[model samples]
Target: MDTQPNIRSYVIDLADQLGIRYQATPEDALADIATRLAGDEVVIDEIEDLLVALKRTGAINGNEMVTLLGQYLDEKFSER
Candidate 1:
């Protein structure tokens, strides 16, 4: 079973590819997601929409996008 931070590897890698600087720490990626999801509640549809947008824009591949979505859901639901 993969941990939540580990599951965000693709996103952090993508950020690195884009030359975006973030904290050199384990929680940075999760923090990034929280920052993005801040103004509103994050729901499954939003996650799906994000996945579609990322895939449509060639930002993330299919399998990994699914994995990311699953991980995101796990993190979200696990917090409840």
Candidate 2:
């Protein structure tokens, strides 16, 4: 049983829960989540956990994770 599709679906579902309205792929959802997280005053644990899980599952690579985190931090700190 291939779990890739299932994992992708789960990512989309999590994105929805995070308030992303339209995401065609896991990467898209991840980017949107990162953007939203950048604007948040406090990091949401569930979303952070989801990102870690995605990384563990190979949905995102280390470089991608670093890029997203960098973007989030840049935006977040620039506001301070």
- Tens-place lDDT digits, model 2, residues 1-80: 75454433455575556554431468857876888888954444444455565566666788876665565555456769
Candidate 2 weakest lDDT stretch, 10 residues: 3-12
Model 1 over residues 27-60: C-alpha lDDT tens digits? Answer: 6457658867786544344444545556656677
* Number of the top TM-score candidate: 1
Quote model 1's TM-score: 0.44
**Highest lDDT model number:** 1
Which regions of candidate 1 are displaced past 4 Å? 1-43
True-structure RMSD, every candidate? 10.2, 14.0
- Candidate 2 structure lDDT: 0.57
**CA lDDT of each prediction against the hidden true structure:** 0.59, 0.57
Which sections of candidate 2 miss by over 4 Å? 1-47
Native RMSD of candidate 1 (Å): 10.2
